[model samples]
Target: MSETTMNTATGATAARGRGAVALTVARVVLALFFAFSAFAKLIAHESAIESFDRMGWSHGAMYLIGALEMAGAVALLVPLLSGVAAMAFVGLLAGASVVQLTLLDPVNAIMPTLLIVLVVLIARDRQDSTAQLIALVRRRA
Candidate 1:
């Protein structure tokens, strides 16, 4: 290959490397946030429980959401599963944002709404990987 071509290829490779690093870091941060929230709900922590109660939600609702959050958090840490996790988070956080706006403090809705944006970015970035995973599963099945 020509020297100029090699340099171009190297630059592209470096860019992709940086993108991957950024995505991985984002995933880690999201995992931490969701895991913390999940534990609070699962443990019936004072603040978490009170928030649910104030919304007129039962214990079951709290537990169910907590479990789902925990699962998503775990999935976020796994490269293959992170895309799926991001997609799931978009849906979950959308519901949370709606509830926060309608049933709870409207201010509280900002966090979930922002998180939805972040997860959507992650989902878009990892779409190729997600498609590959689905393709592999289909081939196997």
Candidate 2:
């Protein structure tokens, strides 16, 4: 290949490598975040308890969210399930964002809003994998 062609090819490959690394990093960070959040709720942390009570949610609701958060964290690391997990987090985080903006300080909504954007990117990036998973399940059914 010509030098220009080789440079272009190499650059494209490098860009893909970077994209993969970014995706991996995002997944790990999201997993750790949700895991810790779940731990906080499961332990009945004072803030979590107060927040749930203020929201008119029962202890059961808190526990359910904690469990779901843990499951979503695990799912984020699984190749076939990462997209699914991200999609789920989009809704979960959206709800949390709304609650933050409406019930608590609007400033508290920042994290969940940013998380929603990240998960949206992750979901878009993993669209093909998610599609394949859906196809496999369809075939099995």
Candidate 3:
């Protein structure tokens, strides 16, 4: 191969490596945020129940939501599952945002909205990574 072609290939590989690292970092940060929230809800049942009551939801619903959050958070740590987890959180966050806007202050809705954006970004990044992996596998085959 020509020298310029080799350099181009090397640069492309380095860029892909950097992209993977950034995606991994984002996944970990998001996973930690969701996990902490879930832990709080699970450990402080009274607080969670009160929060749910304010939202016109039952205490049982609070527990169920917390469990779902915990499951999604755990899935986020797995590379293959992070995309699905992010997609799930996008839906969950959307519901939370709507509830916050309707029942609480507009300011309260901002966090869930922001989280939805982050999860969407993670989902897109994961999709790109998956596509690249599939392309590589096809090339090998």
Candidate 4:
């Protein structure tokens, strides 16, 4: 192959590698944030319960939501499952944002809205990763 062609290939590979690394870092950060949030809900149930009560939800609902968040956080760490987990988180965050806007101050919804955007970014990244993997598999076959 020509030197220019080789250089172009090398640059493409390096760029992909860098993108994968950045995506991994983003996934870890998001997972940690979700895991910690879930842990707080589970370990310090009183606060979660109070928050749910204000929303007219029962304590059991709080526990259920906490468990879902914990499961989603774990799934987010797995490449194959990350997209699904991020989608779930998007839904959860959307609901939380709506509740905050309706029952609490509009300012209270900001965190959930921000989390929704973060999860959307993760979901898009995961989709790109999945597409790359499929292309690789097809090329190999």
* Tens digit per residue, CA lDDT, model 3, 1-141: 999999999999999899878878988988898888898787766767678878888767777888899999999998767887888999999998998888867789999998888888788888865566568779999
Q: Encode model 2's per-residue lDDT on 1-141: one tens digit a residue.
A: 899999999999999999988988999999999999999999999999999998888999999999999999999999899999999999999999999998877899999999999999899998988999999999999
RMSD over all Cα atoms, model 2 = 1.2
Clashing pairs in 1: none
Q: After superposition, how far is residue 62 of candidate 1 from its true place, in Å?
A: 0.5
* lDDT measured at residue 140 in model 3 versus the true structure, 0 to 100: 100
> What local lDDT does model 3 show for residue 11?
100
lDDT for residue 133 in candidate 2, whole number 0-100:
95
TM-score of each: 0.87, 0.94, 0.77, 0.76
Q: Write the per-residue lDDT of candidate 4 for residues 1-141, one digit (tens) a residue.
A: 999999999999999899778877878888898888788778756777678778898767777788888999899998878877888899999998999999866898999999888788788878865576568779999
For model 3 the TM-score comes to: 0.77
> What is the C-alpha local distance difference test score of candidate 1?
0.92
Clashes of each: 0, 0, 0, 0
How do these models rank on TM-score, best leading? 2, 1, 3, 4
Please report the candidate that would top TM-score against the real structure: 2
Model-by-model lDDT, in order?
A: 0.92, 0.94, 0.84, 0.84
Scored by lDDT, the top model is 2
Q: Candidate 3 overall Cα lDDT vs. reference?
A: 0.84
For 40-138, candidate 1 gives per-residue lDDT tens digits of 999999998899999899989999999999999999988778888999999999999999999988998999999898899889888887888899899
TM-score of 1: 0.87
